[model samples]
Target chain A: MRTFSAVYCEWFKLDEKRYLDEVKRSANSHSPFIYPTMELLNENLDNFINHQEETVISFSQLTQYLVMKLAHENELKVLLDGQGADELLVGYDYMTGYYLNQQLRSLNLKSFFEELLTVIKRKNVEGLQLLSYHFSPNFLRKKILYRNKKYLSNRLNNIISQDNFYLSPMYKSKSLTTALIVNVDYKLEKLLR
Target chain B: MTFGIETRVPFLDFRLVVYLLSLPDEYKYKKGTTKRILRDALNEYLPELVKQRKDKIGFASPDFKLLKELDEKHWS
Candidate 1:
């Protein structure tokens, strides 16, 4: 499937901007999913979007990966993964655990090991990296930072269904947008042909 | 693709962008993430049965309950 993927590389390029925008905006913003893998996906998106107009394969390592993925599966779908600094070190899972527990922030996230994940990646807040020391469980400031009641609420409501008491007119506008994106991308794409 | 690849998405239809983008950015983020809007939307589309469903079966638990009667010398 190397040739198949290669044949579609240009198509991937054409759609890359829309896909990249969605992936980055979704992956970068606070959510319940792992970021590093999302990040790796984002980086591959760079080969499509950065517009440097250079070779897609810049080094021997990438060439070897493509070749191996092609020969083994005859389909190049062997799951090229970043493996782990997260699972091994527990980063993405931390943020997810926090996000889940945020529904009831009184519930703690320190005691589960179902999924291996990394820390909540830091993003620039004005200019500061807001999450640099966020994972230290016992650090007072870090604890206060990562466990903020405000952020916890946001992350919880982001993933879980609402209790319906709070579904106001304002909520409908936002819901319409998400509903619109999902239907357009996943449903309508199938029906168009 | 042979027809010069002119593509158009209906939901992302220009008329839609004109209406939505002109609205407030406040609709995007709140407290921390986009959950409020998303949940409200899902509640509308998914049936109440689906919206209320929450049961998952898993085997990832520690096996002590199953292993309590197993012989330690079995491997030998």
Candidate 2:
């Protein structure tokens, strides 16, 4: 129910002036706007490397740390975020491209699935089960041969399943319903928690 | 976890998430528009200008500009 606004501004860049202007324009939309000054730059830099020692600090992580620091200073204990909506809603342009391409390029399913499996193999060590499911000759043949409405429906299900292949090592279940549940329970819940 | 401040994501509500996931991909994204369903759902409640805005600037900060300023002031 409570809404808070904050803006981090730099007095230098012309492009960032637009960002500052936008923040100022939207200031009235939320209550208690908190402007974290440039003076905290050194403190934020110090905090970034204080814990991990060797970990590289990304810009987003630094911004998050600054927000947390500001919240602490203001004595605000809880903050509400709008995370997990993007992943669930396919809000990212890359994901949209992936889904649209997979849907339109049915003829290239074999090579596409193979490339995906290869990437998964290289990036992830626990993707063996998912790789096996996609790499099976029998499954690939059936998926390629079947061209009915039922097959299309199954393909959609497979797409969702493939999207969630990295949720858990035990995520071998092919059911879309179960996959959705697992994604919500394991991934989204873990993030929000 | 470092800040000791609790962050809650209300958008990840179980029912809402289930409904979103169950909806077709077209409903979620359409013609390069992201969060289409969310925009459509909140169309009536939000201001017309707010609803019409397209860009999604997510928690952006001016850290780059700050760093540039520091570099010019101290290093240069």
Candidate 3:
């Protein structure tokens, strides 16, 4: 239940006072806030790169590494985070834009899917290319049937017997379903990597 | 896993993820607000200031600035 935060100096202006104050206020009852200085972070990153023989690491990766190090040093064996919420909830502005654009053209599923495909290709984010297939109802149906042959075969009987099952709202809209599926696929690939 | 400290994401919990994914697009993002559902759900618990904050700085660091300074100092 402990919370750890890395605070930057005022010169950075990245950590606003309001956000930091809120973070401090929300700390768990017994949790201590750990603030690692920029110099310490730099040293840690340098040491990590030298030890691992890596030339570069992303800012996010570096931050995670430092947080993990701090947790290990503090003897905190486990920590809970709020990751993956962004992907699931469309927290990214770009994702929101994509979803809204798709919704606007919901009347024509084909053109909507085509436009989405074009956008995905233009953006060229990983695992997005696979998303195009899901947009095509025919392709998705075939893929699902092939991939879940046993499940599909028993779906008829299960549907008849399972009275408590609830269909997700995502299934009602093709665009939303595609967006969620694509996001999940992209996140899964990132996690695997 | 690199530092031997295990980090679990509760947001990625199976049931929670399913429910969140099922929400309408507007619930997720509306107008200019992102994570609308999360903000609303935590509004009562979180400070009003925090709830109203709009900035989303993800893993931002000043190391780049430091590096630039060092480069300039050395070159100059």
Please give the CA lDDT of all the candidate structures. 0.29, 0.54, 0.57
After superposition, which runs of candidate 3 have C-alpha atoms over 4 Å from their true positions?
A26-38, A50-57, A107-177, A189-193, B70-76
Q: Kindly report which residue pairs in candidate 1 clash with one another.
A: A90-A117, A91-A117, A91-A118, A91-A119, A92-A117, A92-A118, A93-A117, A93-A118, A157-B35, A158-B35
Superposed by TM-score, candidate 2 places the C-alpha of residue B24 at a distance from the truth, in angstroms, of 0.5
Q: For residues A1-193, could you state the per-residue lDDT of candidate 3 as single tens digits?
A: 4666666567778765456566566753444444555455556766667654543323455666776777787888878877787777765534543554455555656654654554454453322423433355753533422232232337654553342122222222346546676667556545432
The positional error of residue B10 in candidate 3, measured at the CA in angstroms, is 1.2
TM-score of chain A of 3: 0.53
lDDT of 3 at A2: 60
Residue pairs clashing in model 2 are: none
DockQ of each: 0.02, 0.34, 0.31
Best by lDDT: 3
| Per-residue alpha-carbon lDDT of candidate 2 for residues A30-82, written as tens digits (9 for 90 to 100) | 33445555555555677666843653323555656666766776777989888
Q: What is the C-alpha RMSD of each candidate to the true structure, in Å?
A: 20.0, 12.7, 13.3
Q: Write the per-residue lDDT of candidate 3 for residues B1-63, one digit (tens) a residue.
A: 666767777877778878887877779764445678989888777777777755454566665
Q: Per-residue error at A153 for model 3, in Å?
A: 52
Q: How far is candidate 2 from the true structure (C-alpha RMSD, Å)?
A: 12.7
Winner by DockQ between candidate 3 and candidate 2: 2
At residue A172, candidate 1 shows an lDDT of 20
Evaluate model 1: give its lDDT: 0.29
Cα TM-score of candidate 3: 0.63
